[model samples]
Target: MTTALLPPATDADLAVLREQLGRPARGVVGIAARCVCGNPTVVATSPRLPDGTPFPTFYYLTHPAATAAMSVLEADHVMRELADALAEDEDLQAAYLRAHESYLADRAAYGEVPEIEGISAGGMPTRVKCLHALAGHALAAGPGVNPIGDLALARSSWSPRRCVCAQPGAAG
Candidate 1:
């Protein structure tokens, strides 16, 4: 029997992802929701292309089973909503929604699910950073400082990882 090659999760790999997310990294900022399996799960929004298009989105990166089971569209829909909620400006929100719709249309025309890669949040991943950046920019554009922690979802199991590379007080 051939053995399947599974990507190994290592402490170093986690460190790299954490560094990419910046020092005080908020684990995965998930929206509280119920999975198709009826189990509660967190939905983390991944980044889009440079052109501001939402691509293959990952759900709970902590749970491989959920991530593997998520359909592209399902992930996209959740990401769209999360992004919209997190977006500081109307333009960004509109852009995210349009991109999502365009992706759906393209998927229907192609008759296959699109491949969403580089969407995992094993550490503080790039996608999460980008979302954080977007949220930050939006908050900066306004009068009141919309703190990242304010929008952060609080759940019993939701605990931000304290990365080895992280400075003291950086762990969110």
Candidate 2:
């Protein structure tokens, strides 16, 4: 992974992604976010995969701890709470809509896929569907860009500022 926003994916980076995902990573355009140890935390993927599948998730969370944290949040029904917050907060709704647009713009830079047009991951601009997607976007775009994502990350057990990559079977 390079310093550029969306550097070209390298073979070494792909290998780490494969390990994190437990499968070969598809449509990965670049490493979007990295752990303190420089391992990939989130990936920027192509709008359309190599298999011709329409992939809508541009920022895909890959870090084992981060993914697990988001899964735990989802399991705890945090999405419902977040959804309630979004419903009540007009400012949150506006920011989420902007995040949705930002996500769309990021994906559009890769290529166009009619099947996923106007669709951003994690139920943006309306609902909280997947914390993993929202957290991934937050990690990739940084704080404040995605309010829902920021909130999700805040509630999660994981912290991007720390390095859990040294854990057993995890990247370091």
Candidate 3:
């Protein structure tokens, strides 16, 4: 199922996001995905920031546990493995290109930014640069859209199905 954008962020939601990110979330359009405990997970950011900066990453992952999981995978050099798999699989390459197109379309819905035109985050349509960005897109867009993101999620120790937001020292 596609994860619809939540209603406009409330003051409380903003506060949680601040804590989750350890800073103010700039140009957040809405909460794209939420934790089971109702905390913001994936945030939909504007194509451009409030300060005239072209921000290409529309689906920003904010969940601390999820972010950490992606980081761990990166540290383990899983991106190299994924990249190799992509090179060997024609269907996967096609799906990844589709994912790149979908990402561009989703960002375009917010606004157009010339500086970031045709650029989707995570080195999409070509390379696996950032698993966090890919996973963010996966969580926001739902399964079957981004196969690489889904694969990373499958390999990660964290699961969005469970709520870790309330756990002590979770912080995000």
Candidate 4:
């Protein structure tokens, strides 16, 4: 959350994550990105979960407002429109391919999970499946890294510049 890179997860962070998820946060490695108010926007998760499942989603969006906004976009069929754009725009397709590579590299930094190799969240590099995952990737990697993610976040009701955390201590 601070400019110092991701800090290790602590008890308080876990507690807040549990509250945010309505279940315990599993295999969280660090806070990948934070909201403007310092609440966690994306938490970097382990490639392999505690239950021995190979989890592919390394950057998990935990902020309630951000998730909700992405949900709204999904509800409005924004992914279909984005997929159409990906089909029509070669530049966007190229950028999204790069983003896919970046996501694989980032996840590999944690550990390897062969089951999920070459796979990134939100159906990246091909189609727009989930804006929440793309937005999480965007927030974690910063702008211009994930083009569709940036577009989704820009078009969404949520803003990284805003703090919509339900409570002061609530973060993932």
Error at 114, model 1, angstroms: 19
Worst ten-residue run, lDDT, model 1? 119-128
Model 1 pairs whose backbones collide: 24-170
> Which run of 10 residues does model 2 get worst, by summed lDDT?
1-10
> Roughly what TM-score does model 3 have, to 2 decimal places?
0.95
Scored by lDDT, model 1 comes in at 0.30
Order of the predicted models by TM-score, top scorer first = 2, 3, 4, 1
- Clashes found in each candidate (C-alpha, N, C closer than 3 A): 1, 0, 0, 0
TM-score versus the correct structure, for each prediction = 0.20, 0.95, 0.95, 0.92
Candidate 4 lDDT over residue span 1-172, tens digit each: 1223366987877776788888998999998888887767789999999999999998899988889889999999999999999999999999999999899888888888989988989998898998989999999999999999999999998898977775554443
The better-scoring model by TM-score among 2 and 4 is 2
What does candidate 3's lDDT look like per residue over 64-141, in tens digits?
999999999999999999999998999999999999988888888788889998999898998999999999999989
**Candidate 4's TM-score:** 0.92
Candidate 3 residue spans exceeding 4 A from truth? 1-6
List of clashing residue pairs for candidate 4: none
Model 2, 1-172: lDDT tens digits are: 1224488888988999988989999988999999988899999999999989999999999999999999999999999999999999999999999999888888888888999999989999798999999999989998988999999999999999899988897865
What's the lDDT for residue 81 in model 3? 98
Report lDDT per candidate.
0.30, 0.90, 0.90, 0.87
